[model samples]
Target: MRSAYSVETVRAAERELMARLPEGALMQRAASGLAAACAELLGRVYGSRVVLLVGSGDNGGDALYAGARLARRGAGVTALLLAPERTHPGGLAALRAAGGSAREAAGGALDGRAAEDGAVAAGVAELIRRADLVVDGIVGIGGSGGLRPAAVPLAVLARASDAVVVAVDLPSGVEADSGEVRGEAVRADATVTFGTHKPGLLIDPAREYAGATRLVDIGLRPHLPPTADLEALQHADVAALLPSPAAESDKYRRGVVGVAAGSARYPGAAVLAVSGALHGGAGAVRYVGPAGDAVIARFPETLVSAGPPSKAGRVQAWVVGPGVGDDAGVVDEVLASDVPVLVDADGLRLADRAAVRARTAPTLLTPHAGEAAALLGTSREEVEAARLPAVRELAARYGATALLKGSTTLVAGPDGGPVRVNPTGTPWLATAGSGDVLSGLAGSLLAGGLDALDAASVAAYLHGLAGRVAAGEGAPVGASEVAATVARVWRDVVGGGWAAPSAGY
Candidate 1:
């Protein structure tokens, strides 16, 4: 799993390192890694023209030190000091000793100083446009929101220029903890982050501006936290978690998933949900609802019953509510079941949060923003603005694992553990019946003996990958097609030919 720490955790780690190591050791380690990444971007450091947009903080110090490294390797490096008086003394000396030049543009001229402020701006702009690459060292974790006036024009010039932009720690102006963009931020082609992965680099908004992220270990292990706030599961971890049948296993022993979904008005939802459960590693799927006939017609393998969930044959897990209408009785029956349950769509509205919390078995709630809004007595806009807080609140309130579905699906457990964000999934998944498929897939995983959070996250990942595969060539795809494509996507994820989806969603 790829874990992401909060800004506070990162700061604590940095402090611990600073207290133990020699004064400049950490910065040097960070600078060395930054220099190596720049070398890779330039193809060859020798004879390359590199410009550093130096600010008044440690971020600029990192860039200056990296510039010094490149200078020793025969690169032509120059620094445009935005704050000459406040620049890091150690870094400035190192750069000059390595033959790097610091130039201040004349009052709108390219020569010597024309007032420090004016010269810095013009000098940085000119150097940015002419250099092969530009290092964005304008701000770091200590920075507040937005760029200082002096750094704004330089950022604009860097963005407009052909030079590749590399950010030292993080792209300036991004919220280090929440990934929110407060104001203007530099868009880097690549970012060299230090010590650990920050939540901002892994989540959206800030993630978009961060470009590609690379981590540099500064050996602050002793100070790191025992747990992270968010994480993304990898293939090896998934492989270890997926259950395999033993030698004495039978169809019943492998686990059966009971599905309560669909109504006469929306029969396709039942078919799609059952389709997802079948490929979700369940030994068998039992369906009980108004759409039983339709499910049998589409997938004869599913065991069908016309009665309520309590009457359905024994199942290890139950997936309730995809297209079920306003039927409080059916919702009650599903909620009272002895097995673990997953509630979704219309079922979410019918469910009594208090009763759900009273249940002894594990319960998972999967709700899109609209459904979640209805359950929480809030607006969809409110839920989206503070997704992490909302998901956690719902999980705590209902005493169940909450899976909030959207662009970045978040799964949170009742115990306040780290939330899992599905890194997979495409916009094509917005099609109808997609949520139904997800409900069934998560239910099947639950039946297969995984915990609620694991089942939900794994199902979400597979469902998203399937959507991407089904939407091949950029054509729109329906939910049923996504259900049918799950097998292929699962095979690819397990090994046959699945390339990691391009970094940012």
Candidate 2:
């Protein structure tokens, strides 16, 4: 599993590491790793035109020191200091000694002195345009809000250039803890972070700005705590959570997932939900809705019932509200049941807030930004901007596990543990029936005995993988194809000598 720390945690860990070592030792360690990464990106550093966008912080110092190393390696490096007077003296001296050049990017001719940030500004843009690589050290994790007006132009110039932009530490202008980019922020081709992975580098908005991320170890792991602020599960971690059938296992012994979805107008929602459940490691699927004929037509294995979910046979877990429209009856029946329940789509709107909170059994809510905004009584923009806070608040308000689905899917529980961030997903997953497939899949995992958080995380991971497979080579794929690919993905995850069956769906 990959873990991400908040900025405060990273700083605390760095402090302890720094105290244990000699002066400047940590900086040297950071600089060496950064220079090596830049060298690798540049392919051949010798004679390469490298420009460092220097600011007034340690991140700028990191860039300067790395630039000094590149200078020593015969790269024609230049440091464009945003704060020339506040530049790192040691790093500046080292660069000069190594035959590197320095210039003020926003003072005198570059600043608004003579012709309104004159010929030097144009000259700096040209340098950025012609450079082989641009190192972004404009701001660090400690900086917040957004880029200043002066630095904004630098960011724009670097982006306007074809140079490969590499960010030092966290990308400038992105909130290191929140992953929010309020105003202007540097969008790099790659980011080389030191010590540990910052939360911003792993979450969205900021993660998007950070095109590709590389972590350089400076021996700070020993100083960090065992628990992290955020966690992302790898294949092995997910494998352990996967459900498997034993030699003596029977269909009833495995687990049963009940799905309550669909309407006369949207019968395909029922078919799609059942399709996901059948492949989602569940022993049997019990369907209770008005679309029994449509579901049975798609999959004969489904146990369908026209009655309410209370009489829809025993279920380890229930998934309600895909295309149920305005039917609040089924949602109330599922909530009243003793089994765990996953609420989504129409269910999210129909289920009473008090009923959801008062449920004795575990509840999992899956909501997109718009749905979440309605639940929280806020705007969609507010929820989307503060996704971490929104998911946590949703879980707290509903007294259930909440999964906020979007570019960066987040799962937060009512118990207030570290949030699990899902790093997989495709924009193509925003299809008609894709969310219904996800609800069924997560409900199956819950039936298979995983908790709400595990169920949501694993489901999101598999759903994303299936989406990628279904949308192979950038083609638009149907929701049924995504469901069809889930079984193939499940086999790939657990590796039980199981090959993907041909066209069973």
Candidate 3:
């Protein structure tokens, strides 16, 4: 699994590690790694033209020092210092000593500089246009909101240029912690980050700005905590979390998932939900709803029940909602049970918030942006824009594990721990009955003894993989087709001869 820490946590770790090392030791280590990454990207750095957009922080120092390294290696390097006097003195000297050219964009002091309004703008644009690589050191993790006016045109030129833009630490103008890009931000082709991965590097908006991240360790590992602020599960991690049936285990010993979904009008939802549960390692699926006949028609093995959840026989876990519109009674009945309950679709609207919080058993709430927005009293666009905070707040408010489904699926628990960002999902999965399928799969995993967070995260991971498999070559796939591939994805995840490295860090 790949993990990410908050900016505060990462800075604390950096400070702790920096205290033990000699002055400038950490910066040099970062510069060395950053320079190496640039060299790798350039392939043949010899006689290459590299431009360093130096600012007024240590990030600028890193870029300058990296430029110095490239200069020594026969690359024609130039530094555009937006803050000439404030730029790292030692780094600037090192670059000049190594045959790197340095030019000042600002006429006077930074605060009073008239650079952006002067002829320097033209020079800056020209240098960026002809560069082999443009190193962005305009801002660091501490900077927020967006790029300063002075760096706007340069950012645009770098992005439009043929030069490979490598952001030092993070791209300028992005919230390193929240991943919010309020204004114009440098869109880097790649980012070279030191110590540990920042939340922004792993999240959207900012993550989208950071084309690809290359980590360069400087012995900050020992200082970081055991748990992270966020985690993205890889294939190996999912494989380990997957449940394996014991040799002596019977069908009853494995698990029984109760799916209380569908109604007279939407019987297809029940069939789709049951279809997912069937392949989710559950020993049996007990269906209790008005669509019982429809479910049995689709899957003959399902244990159909015409009555409520109380008469659905014994089940390790229950999956409620997914087309049971206005069925508050069924939701209440399931919430009162001691077994784990997964609420989705219509159940999200019907269930009482107090009852969900009061339940002693594990409760997993799966909400799409629309459902999540309704629960939070916000708009769907707001929830989609601020997914990390929305998911965390939903989990905290409901006192249950919350899975906020979107382009990026996140799972958060009641305790406010690291949110799991699902790395596997296809746009083709965005079809009718997808969430129903997810709910049933997750409920089955819960019955199989996984915790709410694990069940949801693993379910999303598999659900997404199945969607990709079902929609091969970018074709549109139906929800049933995605569900049909669940077992295939589950098998692949658990070392079934066909597995690739998971998507992101």
Candidate 4:
């Protein structure tokens, strides 16, 4: 699994490791890794012209030390110090000692002298424009907000230039913990992070600024905490988690998933939900609702029943809500079921929070921002602003596992441990009936014996992979198309003849 720790956790780990090592050892490790990555980017360091946007802390120290390394290898390196007075003394000496030169970006220009107001220094701008690469070291974990005034123009210039830009640690101006961008942030072609992956490197908004991320392990493993804030499932991890059928297992033993979805108004929801459930490895899918006829017509394999969830032929798990518009009885029946439950779509709106809280079996609530806002009596904007906090709040308030779906879908438990963020899914998944299909798939996984969080994340990942596959050749895809492609997606995940998509990381 690709795990990400919070900034606080990383800082604590760094502190502990720093205490055990000799002075400047941690910085050297970070700098050496960073220099190696830079060398790769430069193709060959011997003739490359490299510019460093120096800050006032360890971040700048890393750049300076890296610059010193490149200088020793015959690269032309220059440090453009923003905070000259507070520059790292050891790094400065290292750079000068290795044949590198330290130059002050003329207060407003790129040259080594303070420039007059409102005018660009010809020589400074020319040097920046001709550089082979630029390294962003303006801020680190200790930085509070956006780029300082001195770093703004430099970032803009780097962006406008053809030179490759690599950010150290993180793209400055992003909240490393929450992936929130407060103001102007550096957009790098690549970002080399130290110790462990930060949440911003995996999440959106901030993730967009961090082009490609690489982690540098500096022996901080012993100091790392047992739990992290987020994790991404890898191939081997998913392979281990997938359920295998036993030789003596029967359909009933495998597990049945009951889907209580759809109504006369939107009958397609039932078909899509059942399609998802069947692809999700359920022994059998029992359809329970007004749309049973529609489901039976589309999928003859489904066991159709015109009743509520309680009498839905002994299902191991129940998927409720979806398209049961204004039907209080269906919602009531789903809540009364003893099996694990997955609530989604309009059902998310109809579910009684208190009733869900009282259930002894595991309950998973999957809601997009709007539905989640309605459940919490808040605005969708509020939920989007602080997604992690809002998801955790919902989980705690309802005493259930909450899966808040969006660009970065989060799964948080009631007891408040680490929240799992789904790194899959694409913008194309914004199509209709997607959530209904997801709920049914998650219910099937739950019935197949995975825990609430695992079921939710795995279903989400598969659904997203299916969407990408169905969206092949750049055609617009429907929800049914996504459901139809789930089997192929599963095959790919299970290492059965399918290849991983070349475009994805």
TM-score leader: 2
Candidate 1 local Cα displacement, residue 106, angstroms: 13
Per-residue CA lDDT of candidate 2, range 1-505, in tens?
Answer: 7888988899999999989999988988888989999999999999999999998899888998999999999999999988787888888888889889998887455444532342334478888999999999889999888887778888888899989999998889998988888888999999999888888887777888988888899999999999888888777777789999999888888899999999998999989888888878989999999999999988999999997888878899999999999999999999999989999999999999999999989999999999999999999998888888889899998899999999989999998888898866689998899999999999999998899999999999889889988898888988999999998888887884333221100
Candidate 3 is scored at a TM of 0.94
Query: Clashing residue pairs in candidate 1, if any?
Result: none
Candidate 1, RMSD to the unseen true structure: 3.7
Tell me the whole-model lDDT of each prediction, alpha carbons only.
0.85, 0.88, 0.89, 0.84
Q: lDDT tens string, model 3, 1-505?
A: 7888888998899899889999999999999999999999999999999999999999999999999999999999999988787999999999999999998764444465476553354476788889999999989999987987777877888999999999999999888877778889999999999988777887676788998888888899899999999998888888988888999988888899999999988999899899989888889999999998889888999999986899889999999999997889999999999999999999999999999989999999999999999999999988876788899999999899999998888899999999998878888988999988999999999999899999999999999999989999999999999889998888887875556544223
> Compared with the true structure, what per-residue lDDT tens digits does model 4 show for residues 84-119?
878999999999999998877645444433432323
Model 2: which residue pairs collide? none
Off by over 4 Å in 2: 107-122, 496-505
Which ranking of candidates, highest TM-score first? 2, 3, 4, 1
Tens-digit lDDT track of model 1 for 456-487: 98999889889989999788999888999999
Deviation from native of the Cα of residue 289 in model 3, angstroms = 1.4
Candidate number of the best lDDT: 3
Q: Compared to the true structure, candidate 1 yields what TM-score?
A: 0.89
Give stretches of model 4 more than 4 Å off: 106-125, 496-505
CA error at residue 231 for candidate 4, angstroms: 1.2
Q: Select the stronger candidate by TM-score from 1 and 4.
A: 4
lDDT of 2: 0.88
